[model samples]
Target: MKKNLKPTITASFLAIAISAIACQNNSGKTAQTDSLKQDTSKFLTQPLISNIYTADPSAHVFEGKIYIYPSHDIEAGTPENDNGDHFDMRDYRILSMDSVNGKVTDHGVALDIKDIPWAGRQLWAPDAAYKNGTYYLYFPVKDKNDVFRIGVATSKTPAGPFKAEPQPIKGSFSIDPAVFTDDDGTSYMYFGGIWGGQLQRWKDGKYDANGSKTDSQKEDEPALTAKIAKLSNDMLSFAEPVKDVIILDKEGKPLLTKDHDRRFFEGAWMHKYNGKYYFTYSTGDTHFLASAVSDNPYGPFTYQGTFMEPVQGWTTHHSIIEVKGKWYIFYHDTQLSGKTHLRNVKVTELTHNADGTIGLIKPLKK
Candidate 1:
């Protein structure tokens, strides 16, 4: 009876193994489908606000709601007075939505340029974060000496009449301040812009020089670099040295250039998903919203390519966030004003690939 039984037994085992593998594969596909899937019914429409020109949208989730702290742009420059650069912004407004498909409410002006002692009139890009139940707003403005500096404002609630701190964060001389808090309760700040500058600093007020501002050598300086740093426990200052994180192409090489088609301009936004760091930015001159990714927060990130193109030829700036399991990108356009500098805040649902890469976002006209 046992003369030829070994071969039969082996074949039976192999058949069972193959069936189990097939079952497992089918299960995995189902799970992935459920995870990557989303319902569009819950998403709010683009151009979150209509009456005002809002730019540089920085979004944060606090107490189950998404709050947007954006720069309020106004038409102040005339041909006789402007130096050809007409982005005349002066204050910030806080807008919030209660539910996934809820209406956006303008909480009105949260902070003003006149309230900040160290800042000048041009209040540029801003960001907000929540910590230990307190909300902190970081803003970039020209200093009294005409130098750009990042300043902080604080509020007890998400929608505030936020009070500005008297002085700028010392040693922070650039635009766009993005704050990120990690899982371990540690916080970090990433910032910077044109002329070969991109920097990071810790919450304790220490700058990360590994990715700090580098001096330009060429006549057309390539300054599309972005940077990151850890933040102190209080979240009011830098806690570590800044690192100039490099954005590389898909081939794992740096996309070295100053042109918008290949480089990062201003509007630095940081987001973490599935333990990966996504650094999203606005491309200079071209006005496209581009992105890069890295395993570590302070990275030498690999450029993933442009996710969103220009909105009617206006410069685009944005932030990405996930609320209630749905992803969204908050950006700005000139639909309301029809002018380059006067932009209005917009929001649309964002999608990611199974590999954690973001998909290209086409601006919605509606």
Candidate 2:
């Protein structure tokens, strides 16, 4: 869902900087100070592209090249709120690289809100899939009714000027659509996000405009879970009813609503390693990237642990992929603009343990 309440740049700092600049006569000094403020030297992995703001990176390997599908961010001047009105993204731009730290190419605008007949605004996080010589782009955006729905766009080439369907996939709601194709050629879409993502609004399979801001308020009740569904062969529609993805504890009980640190929040991602299905997600407000494991695509997954600690921003979203036998994670933070809504994507090496557990990754280099 990609909403952050914290402001990376504090008000006091802004005030002090403005006062200092006003008292100075040299415009050159002011320009130099602004440049220094945008310094990204402390980041463990530098941003993939700096020409524009991007976030919620969905990385994949298509035809031996790394392709990224991310939300194109802009300063829309909308006020921030719990409903995520400030993340006023209107388009998507694809990125590609030959290697982990290689030069990244931004393939201009792949799709825009105006191109989709049903889309309203806020083109959030998106994922890409390939099948039968065609590429599919899955995304979440608000419709004219202001309800978020999942939409699909198609392209013949990996880097696309994609053509979107006239309407969103039927029965699709909420946000963060991630599609994973298994070795058997079956693809499952994992989605749903609490809070601003609007997953909690669909408790009874209907959109409730005045839904709970968080998950089930009861400490003993099962937490609101992420949603999953099998994608039809055509990849334009769901093959079955959307189901809840359950995360269990060591004793095999469902993760309770009170378990804020480990419960599913948003940014659902699945990857296969060592014949096991790894389900990873963001713990939105708590700001951790956690994982669970299951033998089947539809999971009663057991909680593993947090793989990534909090970054410099309020919202964290990511994707994991394997390239040439090496695994890497693509994620975003507020290092570039020092604002929650404007983020930059980055990539770093990911390690899987011998026992099938993921190693904890500290986003900060130090």
Candidate 3:
């Protein structure tokens, strides 16, 4: 049931060009300046949908089609801050495509904040899974107490008019819930984010209203890691205690807090490739998409290097999925609006090297 949504390509193209200029001026880097001087058109990847702003795309293949569940970005007047008050998104619209670079369908508003009984506002990044004839939409949002908690919604179809549970998922906190189902039918959720994501606030297993935005003020101490837990058989809650997904350097030592280029900031996504598990996430303030590899689903992963360069936005969230025999990474940038809060989702092909390391991705073509 696709709706007749008109394309806003003309206006979006103009904005994209303007955003390239703005990024060059703001960055003042010689490489960026040189690239901008050559071909401004290469500065942006075409957005999947231009009619409405979207971000934090969690893409999946369901029933031989590509379905994307992303945060529905809006121009909420809340001021931008380190705490992320301006990303006041309230709902989600599911996007679908028949194949790569094919006609995309905006299935309209699949879920809204008002329908979720426990949610307060700011419906952020989400992920989806299909099992036992039901589709589960996993999302992170602020609760009545202003704490970010993860919740699940269910629907009969992949493109959902999902019905959320009356309460938040017990023992789930922080943001960005990425549910990865293993080959044995076991599903594990990898989640957590620092800064405005509130992962640092729960260091003592209790929420602290007063907590630092950064992780481990001491740089030598271990960086705060992402959390993982096995989902219950019904997929409503955690089956076991949440455990930290430890990331280590090649020397097998924990990454220090000051290692911004490698430390985990947020946006945890897991995918299995060639019998190895790949855990990837964004290095928030540093603006890089980095990865680590482990032999097990619950990992003490060793650090790999950056796979993606910065886009035109402050936040970088993504999902990697295999389509047919090819893999693609879905992400978002501010090209459509030239404002951080108003973003547009885009996708590009990804490659894994013969040595199992991921090839670096440049969101904007050089």
Highest TM-score against the true fold, candidate? 3
Better of 1 and 2 by lDDT: 2
The digit string of per-residue lDDT tens for model 3 on 41-128 reads 7764577666567799999999999999999887667899988989898888888888876767777778889999999988999999
Model 3: lDDT of residue 98:
80
- Using TM-score as the yardstick, the better of models 1 and 2 is 2
**Candidate whose lDDT is highest:** 3
Question: Backbone clash tally for model 3?
Answer: 0
The Cα local distance difference test for each model comes to 0.67, 0.83, 0.85
Rank list by TM-score: 3, 2, 1
User: Which residues of candidate 3, in runs, are more than 4 Å off?
Assistant: 1-40
Model 1: per-residue lDDT, tens digit, 49-78?
443567888888888887888887766653
What TM-score does model 2 achieve against the real structure?
0.89
Tell me the deviation in Å of residue 185 in model 2.
0.3
Candidate 2, poorest ten consecutive residues by summed lDDT: 23-32
